[model samples]
Target chain A: MTSISIIGTGKMGSAIAEVAARAGADIQIIRRRAGAGSSLERGDAEYGLVGDQLTGELVVLAVPYEAYPSVLGHYRDRLDGKIVIDISNPIDFTTYDELLVPADSSTAVELSQALPAGARVVKAFNVNLGDTLSTGTNGTTTTTVLFAGDDPAAKIAVADLIEAAGLRAVDAGPLSRARELEAMGFLQIVLAAIGKTRYESGFALLQ
Target chain B: MTSISIIGTGKMGSAIAEVAARAGADIQIIRRRAGAGSSLERGDAEYGLVGDQLTGELVVLAVPYEAYPSVLGHYRDRLDGKIVIDISNPIDFTTYDELLVPADSSTAVELSQALPAGARVVKAFNVNLGDTLSTGTNGTTTTTVLFAGDDPAAKIAVADLIEAAGLRAVDAGPLSRARELEAMGFLQIVLAAIGKTRYESGFALLQ
Candidate 1:
């Protein structure tokens, strides 16, 4: 079984842990404190290794966009030679539809810049609702999850996790597509505001 | 029957025709040219007011965003005392995900300003897909269409047309919500590009 390490035990982080654990994968969770056994609770680790702390080939960053830089600083060393899946959207709640990041850059790009040498960053699960991720099924009719990364193997690894979670993994080319993906996320929220669509559920492309 | 005039007959315009006409409404379509009940063929009238002949309490601007200014200019005098629905989104196709209008201004806002005195402008039907309008049903489930306008009576009339076309109509409060609605349209395209969702459907609030 492929081993996985999940950072952040919040709503999305915990949900990813639960689903990944249930899918028959060996999962390790890193919290604020240190622990000896599996499934360490929050506030368990103090001054952890960037990449060496977790014994998994894949690491999932489930922190908020604002916390991304600090999270990377704490785990950059451990991240080298591992696939890092980014599921954060840098949204500016203050301005509603206006993006908080610069026009020429994206959060994924920012995270990539924060990574240590040889670290692979891939963006996925940014468009999906956290509630749906924890409760939905991956049976006959699976919802599509998009993944974009510079490394083909890294994308494949994340795609496997998405499929194992019972969803369809669609490769949306490279990391630049993350801009479009984040913009789509903003659009989804706007539609939800007007009661046109919901976060618990979303569109499935027919074409 | 409520008499309605559709100012453009393109794919979306034709889809609007299908919706309004199917509702048993007296529909008059002003194609590119001017004549006695002319077909939506090609180049009919010179930009504005197509022969200065139009008779309807309600007029739908079914043209492109680039043609919005000209369409508004032509109908300025004729649109007086009538309800005008602007179903256009000023999206910059060249930049893909960037907004064409300035940060403070929007396409609908511009149209509202260009209207003649006493004419009421409503922004609606800009988020729904043409195929969705044509199909009327999303995977065996009926969907909802949202609308926003400054005039209460005009919104009610538009809502009636939406219901007549076989979908639920949601009044998203005021015309200022148009910014949010237009952003939703942009998001739909982004989600569609990455295969995360279909643009042919909308969200319905349970509450």
Candidate 2:
């Protein structure tokens, strides 16, 4: 079974943990402090300290875009040679209309730049909503988990986890393509806010 | 039948004319010169000069993002009280990695600002690829035509045209949401370049 470590205990983080746990993966939820009640209530997962040794091969950074630097700083030493997944959409919350990142860059690319040399950053789950992640489907269609990474092996590993969780995994090419993925995610959020899809919709690439 | 006028005779413009023709709309194709052989070969569309008097209630600016200023400049006097649809995606073609428009604005919003006071600019068909617009489907699934405009009546008119073309019409709220739609279109183009969807795929908002 693929072991997974999820950082952050927000709705998205908890939802990812739930899905990963349901997929029979050995799940560990990492919080800033063990006493924090924000950790998910899933029985298959155990809460761990952020600075401790991460037992899972895959570590998912499910925190908001702003918290990335602090979280990465706190766990910098432990993240070397680990496969890190970035699911944060760098949206400008003030207006909720535009992306907060640079016009040519993405949250995943920025995170990848700040990571330790060996940390392989893969962009995933940013496109999938928390509701879809928890339920694994949007209405009659299965939710698609689009991921992008520089490492082929790392992308395959992430794809394996997504497939295990009863979702379709789409490889969206190199890590540079994270910009596009994040843009799509931003669009979906705006669409939801505007009552186009009611926040219940997930993006599907029609064949 | 909903009468429609299409500006420009490129792939996108021609495809829109074809779809409109297929849907039984009274289609008129506008070219810089009436003798230009580049106009759509469809038997249903009547060819006309760009500076000529347009008869359709709805006019589609299917030109490139760069040509918007010139096209709108020449037709600025004639566009008063007309429903103008902006289908241009302001993508930075040099890099094909980022949008050329301002971060907070969109092509439609920019064009609206440049149009005559009474010309209602609606953002539609910018998210749909030319292939999907031509065929009206990515596979068995109908392609979604997401549109946004500040005017309620204008959006409904554009939606009617989209539905008449046998595609799904999704109202994505006011004109401000065009930024998101254009961003989504840029992402789709990038996805195609990266071989994620092969340019044959269209985005669908699955419930």
Among the numbered candidates, top lDDT falls to: 2
- For each candidate in the order shown, give its overall lDDT on alpha carbons: 0.68, 0.82
Interface RMSD of 1: 6.1
What TM-score does each of the candidates earn?
A: 0.73, 0.85
DockQ scores of the candidates: 0.17, 0.51
* Fraction of native contacts under 8 Å reproduced by each candidate: 0.04, 0.66
User: Can you give the lDDT of residue A99 in candidate 2?
Assistant: 80
CAPRI rating of model 1: incorrect
Locate the minimum summed-lDDT window of 10 residues in model 2 chain A: A198-207
For the second chain, the TM-scores of the candidates in order are 0.85, 0.94
Cα error, candidate 2, residue A98 (Å): 3.3
Q: Write the per-residue lDDT of candidate 2 for residues A30-96, one digit (tens) a residue.
A: 8866777454667778778778778889999878888877887888767888999999899989987
Write model 1 residue lDDT over B19-111, tens digit each, in one string: 776666767677655453333432322222354566656788888888877776677878888888888777777765556765445567777
TM-score, prediction 2: 0.85
lDDT value, residue B146 of candidate 2: 85
